[model samples]
Target: MKTLYIVRHAKSSWKYSGIEDIDRPLKKRGIKDAHLMSKFLSKEIARPDVFISSSANRALHTGIIFCENLEYPLANLQINRQLYSFSDGYLVKTVYALDDAFNSAIIFSHDHGINTFVNKFGNTPIAHVSTCGIIGIKFQEKHWKNIKKGKTFMVEFPKNHK
Candidate 1:
């Protein structure tokens, strides 16, 4: 079985003008939400075998917070530029490329992609995955490449905790 956790990056700051979208860091509220969600999730779930994040500042920062709270090594977190995409196809390709050796993995990414992926690959239909939200899906397949539609057993959002 393979368990995949998809995390939408925490809220990002648009205060800085002229900064590229990829360089937008998390806002103060985003930081707090990341910490809150990570600490909350750490108690609810086991440490994931692998952590993957988009190279974007907000996404990577959110992943780091989760890694720290979950007691997973920061060095082990894989940053994939492809995960920075908003396209569901890119997200699908990225998931399909995951190493089968790891039974469980967490991915930190953007919104439209996150929403699309959960709707496509998970049994549950979520209208939107808010910032700092996490959706956990479990697949019956042993390999990532073979993953079809999976059971969406968990849905966590920052607003829900507050």
Candidate 2:
């Protein structure tokens, strides 16, 4: 079995004028939300063997908060440039390329692709993956390539917690 956790990067700051979207930092609320979500994931979800994140600043920051709160070693994280604003196909390819040594992994990425991937793979009507939200899926197959639509055993959102 394989466990995949798809997490959207937390809210980003618009404080810096003329900053590229990829360089935007997390907003104050984003930081707080990241901490909260990380606490919840650390206490509730099983520890992931691998932490994969987009190279974008916001996504990387979110990954950092999660790793810190969960006590996951920083060395365990891999910053993948392809994950930054990647398409669904790119996301799938990244997942397929994951190291087999890890049975569980977490991905920190942007919207649209994240939402599309989860909705397609999970076979649900997931409209949007809000900032700092998490969508967990369990695949019956051992290999990521074997994963397909409707294979999810569970799905969750931060709003559901509220």
lDDT of 1 at 86: 91
Segments of candidate 2 deviating more than 4 angstroms: 150-156, 159-162
Tell me the tens digit of each residue's lDDT in model 2 across 1-162: 888999999999988999888999999988888988888888887789899999999999999999999899998789999898657777898888887778989999988899889988885677778998888888888788778864555455556555
> Quick one: best lDDT, which candidate?
1
Best by TM-score: 1
Residue 142 in candidate 1, Cα distance off native in Å: 0.7
Tens-place lDDT per residue, model 1, 1-162, is 999999999999999999999999999999999999999999998999999999999999999999999999999999999988998887898889998999999999998999999999999999999999999999999889999999999999999888
Which lDDT value does model 2 have at 110? 89
lDDT of each: 0.95, 0.86
What's the C-alpha lDDT at position 12 in model 2?
95
**If scored against the real structure, what TM-score would every candidate get?**
0.98, 0.93
TM-score of 2: 0.93
